[model samples]
Target: MSDARRPNPSNEIMRRKWVRQLRDALLLPPALLYVIIEEIFWNGATALLRQIARTWPVRALQKQLMALPAPVILPLFLVPEILSHIGGFWAAYLVTRGEWAAAMVAGIVIKGSATLMVVWIYQSCERKLLSIRWFAVVHRQALRGRDWVLEKIRPGKELALRLLRRSRAGIIRRFAAIRQVLAARLGFRRRS
Candidate 1:
């Protein structure tokens, strides 16, 4: 058999192992950062949203939103997102004017509220919105992109989650101690 035609199972396996290690080396730090940010920020927002979703008015609004047709849903979805960008830009202008606290408040109030609205409406009317061909295509593309990122970061995500699980109890205990100390310092009595 020619050298080029010879089977090389061991070499092929080694090459794959090397490639995987290299990929992990390159992607692990960013993946860990992504995990931390998602846990800290997105989880909090999602928890708050879940609480809001249980309210009577929000439930009624969700029902009304779900009844919307694809055409109406498209504008409803896009408008909030556009307004959010405008709010973000206004926040940036405030920053440029040295209005630090105003910028922070605007960012949290306007952009944050708009984000909640967009997420709520999207969750409410997702099926109706996806009935539109273009919207469905875009949604599919976004999902594919998300899937690709998740796949690339799978190993890192697993490691981060494992470490987080191991550290969680310690973190909670430390936070509880700190909270107690702060409360005592602030003259707040513990409720036995």
Candidate 2:
């Protein structure tokens, strides 16, 4: 005989309490979705987001959502944002007992060091931290832009010309003397 039990037709039933539990359970997973979307949007989805936005569920869903004014739906994002602060608070609670409060107070610390660790965990554990390689790429582009700006603001060529005028002969003399010394040291005599 098969070990698998036959379906219970009676189990098709669901109550208001069950529906409430289902909705509540969904709230937690929305946070997970929030985390995933944020990571992709910031890091990975720049190329694919347009295609995604054009697709059936996202396009249709966004259409419905856009019908509601921004104010009405803005609170949807607030859930995870508040949870982030609450996460910091809980992590602070973990570090501090009654007597430890003095340490936090004496330093006049706005938040304990644990807050930074908590925020980092919030970023990485949620897989929202941008890859370090991508960050370096972005930083390199920013540096290039900055260098371009400095080039635009650079001193006139006349100033550079002035700086080179006296130094040019000195530079040439130094190089020629070094070459002559090397020629002498290497026993290479000039033909008369």
Residue runs of model 1 more than 4 Å from their true location after superposition: 1-43, 83-107, 173-192
Residue pair clashes in candidate 2: none
lDDT per residue for candidate 2 within 1-192, as digits (tens), equals 453576545554556568866865765454444433333333423333443455577667655654554344434333544554454454346447655655445322333222333333333222222234554475478456545434543565368777888689998899789878866775553658
Estimate, for each residue in 25-112, the C-alpha lDDT of model 1 and write its tens digit.
8876655544443344345556557867877998998888888778988888888777766767777789899999998888778767
> What is the overall TM-score of model 1 with all chains considered together?
0.58
* lDDT score at residue 35, model 2, on the 0-100 scale: 37
TM-score of 2: 0.23
The 0-to-1 C-alpha lDDT of every candidate, in the order given, reads 0.75, 0.47
Clashing pairs in 1: none
User: For candidate 1, what is the lDDT?
Assistant: 0.75
Location of the lowest summed lDDT over 10 successive residues in candidate 2: 121-130
